[model samples]
Target: MDLDSAFAALGDPVRRSLVARLAHGDATVGELAAPFDLTSQAISHHVGVLRRCGLVEQRREGTRRPCRLRTDQLALLSTWIDDQRRTWADRLDALEQHLTDEGADR
Candidate 1:
């Protein structure tokens, strides 16, 4: 999914908390909903959004559906971060070269 969808899915505080919980381990819907003040239905809706964004996965085990974090999507975030770092490194290298050349001229 695109970054916009990922960001939108994570925009909710409830969704963010849910993701954090899933990070520890996979949990059933009931387990995920237990700590929240909201109803199970509300929690389910949040999970649905996360699923749509490719951030979480849900699987049925007998009768219960367990939710788990899909970390592969996080590669998109990593890729973006790496791109930013590369850009900064290039700029810093250019500045260093400029300074060194200026010093040599003095």
Candidate 2:
């Protein structure tokens, strides 16, 4: 999944909250909906976005549908952040070397 789609899915506070809840343990849709004032359908919509983003997975347990966190997708986020950090560090190091070289010349 693209980062844009994943970020869009995570843009909603409700979706983020639902993901946080799922991180604790697998929970049924009804159980997941309990903390919010929203309807089950609303919660389902949020969950759908999260599932599409690969952050969560759902399975039917008899009549109940339970949702669980899939942490592997988080590695994608981690990787992106790490890449940006490395790029910034490289630039900073270059700036430091340039300053040191100028000082030596002075």
Candidate 3:
């Protein structure tokens, strides 16, 4: 997955909302648009952005193409966040220890 594209695509509030909704279950573009003030085409455009970013997938079922959240792609994003968290935590811990040691020497 292209993390940069995925991150950029999720930068939009509408796309984020669509992802959140899809988390519960898959829904057609029409179904996804019901709660929004935007037209179905607008919702479809958002979904297209998600699809391009690998955050969502659409499948044909009869007359409907339901969009589903790609959890594996989300997992990649989560993993990236966790890794950054760990790196920052380690840096802070090292700084704290350095301060503690300096204080002890004083």
Candidate 4:
């Protein structure tokens, strides 16, 4: 999955909500469209953005195409976030140690 594209696609609140909803279960365009005030076309556009980012996928089932979450992309994003968290935590710990050492010296 392209992290940049996924992040950009998720930057929109509507897209984020869509992602959150899909986390529960697969949904069709009509179901996804029902919650929002926007038209079905707008929902389709959002879904397209998600599809382009590899965050979600649509599958053909009879007459309907249900949208499912691509957990792999979400996993990648989670991993990236965890890495950032660890790096910052280590930096903060080092800064705290340095401050404590200085306080002891004074």
Model 1: how far residue 71 lies from native, Å: 0.7
True-vs-predicted CA distance for residue 25, candidate 2, Å: 0.9
**Could you tell me the lDDT of residue 98 within candidate 3?**
100
Q: What would the per-residue lDDT of candidate 1 be over residues 1-106, giving only the tens digit for each residue?
A: 6788988888889998998999899998789999988888999899999998899999988998999998888778668779999999999999999999999999
lDDT of 3 by residue, 1-106 (tens): 9999999999999999999999999999999999999999999999999999999999999988999999999999999999999999999999999999999999
The CA lDDT of each predicted structure is 0.90, 0.88, 0.97, 0.97
Name the better of 2 and 4 by TM-score: 4
Separately for all candidates shown, the number of backbone clashes (residues 3 or more apart, or on different chains) is 0, 0, 0, 0
Q: Name the better of 2 and 3 by lDDT.
A: 3
Compared with the true structure, what per-residue lDDT tens digits does model 4 show for residues 20-106?
Answer: 999999999889999899999999999999999999999999999999999988999999999999999999999999999999999
Report the lDDT tens digits of candidate 2 across residue range 1-106.
Answer: 6788888888889988987898799998889999999899998888888888888899988998999988788778779989999999999999999999999999
* Reference-based lDDT, residue 38, model 4: 95
Report lDDT (Cα) of residue 8, candidate 4: 96
The runs of at least 3 residues in candidate 1 whose Cα sits more than 4 Å from the true structure, single-residue gaps closed, are: 92-106
Candidate 1 residue pairs in clash (backbone atoms < 3 Å): none
TM-score of predicted model 3? 0.96
- Write down the TM-score of every candidate: 0.78, 0.85, 0.96, 0.97
